[model samples]
Target: MAAFVLRTHDYRTISRCLESYGLAVERSAATWPQRRFTDAAERRRAVATVTALGEDPAGTESAGYFHTRLHLAR
Candidate 1:
């Protein structure tokens, strides 16, 4: 099972990325949202693909999918 404990903003970005790739990303309604990749190979592939897209400046991701500005303490 693949689970990610990240900021809601980050998860939304990742969800969009996964959906754009036509991958079914399931989410849990629990306190902490959960995502699972049942197949090891598929899991790795998805991670790799998403990582690459996140690093691309040409895409909506624009070199990073994370929105850390909000997480920083003012």
Candidate 2:
């Protein structure tokens, strides 16, 4: 599966990116949000969307394990 590290500051951009990929938000975390894809095409689209948004995509072998990091400017 594909994973990504998205910054909180870019949440909106990422959300838009994911929407572009046709993946709906499945859940959210305190620092990260999770997205589920219905198929491989959606997964690829999600990865591309996040990558285009400048987030680093990390591919993992773990089932239902997508992790991301969030940062806030002080």
Overall lDDT per candidate, in order of appearance: 0.41, 0.48
TM-score of each: 0.33, 0.38
lDDT for each residue of candidate 1 in 1-74, tens digit (9 for 90 to 100)? 24443322346566567677777666543222134445666445544654554522222222233212121111
Q: Model 2, 39-71: lDDT tens per residue?
A: 776566666665676655565212222445542
Candidate 1 worst ten-residue window by lDDT: 65-74
Model 1: which residue pairs collide? none
Predicted structure 2, TM vs. truth: 0.38
Which stretches in model 2 have alpha-carbon errors above 4 Å? 1-33, 59-74
lDDT of 2: 0.48
